[model samples]
Target: MANKTAPLTDTEIRQAKAKEKEYNLGDGKGLLLRIKPNGSKLWLFNYQRPYTKKRAVLSVGSYPEVSLKQARQTRLKYRELLANDVDPKDYKQEQEAQAKEALTNTFEHVANLWLESKRDTITSGHFQQVKRSLEKDLFPSLGKKPISTLKATSFITLLRSIEAKGSLETVKRLSQRINNIMNYAVNYGLIEVNPAQAIGEVFKKPKKKHYPTLKPEQLPDLMKALNTASIQLQTRCLIEWQLHTITRPSEASGTKWSEIDFKQKTWTIPAERMKSRIEHIIPLSEQALALLDIMKSINGNRQHVFSSRINPKKPMNSATANVALKRMGFRGVLVSHGLRALASTTLNEQGFNSDVIEACLAHIDKNEVRKAYNRSTYLEQRIKVMTWWSEHIESTSQNHLLTTKKSRLKVVT
Candidate 1:
């Protein structure tokens, strides 16, 4: 129960200054209004918790700044938290600790710290995936360099070296990774400008390569084999989800249970996790909805859809799906990510409008006039084209309905 006593008047407050037990004066039960012998009042809260067996003191406010009504309200909120099986003291302590940690987390320091902290947040398996690229390819070459000194030219040269190695795709993703690091550095106030900006302008993007897609005749047997593969349930779901919606394998694999909007049949990916720093809205196909329904039956409560068997909090290692393809004897015949290439190439070869294809791949077309004038990826046209492509892939893969019929692609978006 809360105290119902009247607030101490100024004369009473002055009188209390002369007594020892009543030296402190305040309206709240725990908050003490300490009166200076010369007549000044300060408010404080005294309490104890059983777990630590520690007595803690909290200062409410001083004199007129913290009125009798205001100090009482603060006490009520804290008591309510304690009554509801919560520990207000513990909550405050944790908040203080987090603030302290965040204070020390400077840009240069936390760049390394962010990578290390993710070790527990991600898996050893996924950690190895990120480590090989960050350490062997990236960090060793540029890790110690101060972020402020990293110029656009130096950043481009670093990528060009990797591009020279025949991994055009790696170059693309490396640009993304470098941008992520620079963005992290920006958050920690290490740098004002991102060296990775205008990356597309800085480096020549390789001609988009085609993925080795299964011919229309191959879909049924592949689906059947996938259905019966004991260890590949999660992988199959991830693959089907990507195919049905034309999403990147990484985006599909990292789908958080919360990001799914089942009612709207959409998956909105945040820009931070995307290759482009733009939010991507993937309009789900019916096939995608079905796959999500099946996925929910198995891993509904977990954070990630394709969580590692060892760690349920993080997504499965990127290699897991690709490696499974190898084990199933589809290594050279098929690839986990080749699906995107397959979709883009086959759709173009089939003669769909180029704008539709670009929209499907989330590619933006820019020209001096159009670039300045048109910015939206026309969802109306894109929706129709993507639906047709989904139907085409599904039809060919399942029933071997091969079509040489083609449409001229016009990149209008």
Candidate 2:
């Protein structure tokens, strides 16, 4: 008959000294305190495989780090696995793997994955905005947390912080992004629910403010001021091109020489450069053609029509036109984007067809049915409208200049 060993005590473990040969101090069924010859102590579990019934040893942890009570608790867990016919070694390996995966499945990790998946679908500028928003706002607080642990309240707190900064629009946008990332996690089975779905209910809706624009009657003074402003001619031409073509500031600044067709009298902005993600065709007026001729004389050799003076390899800064407008004493009166509103309102008031105006502005049609068939529907009419608009601007500026000269002569007399 074999002698039964008693369970280990804390005092016995501490008092036990190492010998030349390492020995095991049994703490009953399968739990042993291993004292090595070098005076190091460790906890080990002796177990049997249910299938083959082979004996195996598993290392629980270093002694004292894993106390005697904790070692016994672990031994009980292994015994429960044995009762269920599971191999303790295999179960431990599976648990370790799951723990590692949990660490890797962090909120930052999934957000980056979602961004990478959309890289080819979104424009570089739009992609940069999303990346910056995540890095600056979302990533700092919740990045290290596991995605599965994120709750709706966690996201609401994050959004409210952004709202506190008076950036309500940014809060709305960031919330939508968070909802997208959570939905992505749900689709992959990493999480069961999207906590961000209900976050919008808590935020205050952003107030609408129209861009400051010059009225049609105000166009003459603006044009005169632009012409005489102490700015680079390249910048002056950029502002004029934006007005004549009614393009966004980004579109004007990013124009490349290759996009212009002097023979066709047209400039074709590619889909990647357009806000609507659709290609836009602008028919060049004689005025626009003359401007291009002058620009070609100066920048035809460069890639960007409005190439940066400091770095010829890149496009001019998108803010160049707006800064010039501000410098010309139009800071609160008008902005670069205000040019679009001015053209749209004036043309609509003048009884131009709404469809033609929208097409010329490259505005996306909201109605899905009409959008399917109406792309490029107003090409001929747009050509005529653009010519009329350009000629009107030139005539307005000339009339303003003549009127100003007369007023000056009257004062001199």
Point to the candidate with the largest lDDT: 2
lDDT of 1 at 162: 76
lDDT per residue, candidate 1, 286-351, as tens digits?
556667777887788898877878888888776677776777667788877777766777677667
**Number of clashes found in candidate 1:** 5
Model 2 earns a TM-score of 0.82
- Candidate 1: C-alpha RMSD to true structure equals 18.1
How well does model 2 score by local distance difference test? Answer: 0.86
Which regions of candidate 1 fall more than 4 Å away from where they truly are?
1-134, 137-221, 224-230, 368-377, 396-413
Candidate 2 lDDT, tens digit per residue, 1-413?
A: 98899988999999999999999999989999999999999999998889899999999999889999999999999999999999889999998987787689999999999998877766678889999999999999999988978899999988887899999989888888998999899998887888788788799999887888999988889888976789988898899899989999989999998999888999999988887777888999877887788788888999999999899999999899989999999998899999999888878877888888888898888998777655746777887778777776776675332122211111100
Output the lDDT of residue 397, model 2: 72
Question: Each model's C-alpha lDDT?
Answer: 0.67, 0.86
lDDT value, residue 234 of candidate 2: 88
- Tell me the deviation in Å of residue 315 in model 1: 1.6
**Each model's RMSD to truth, in Å?**
18.1, 6.1
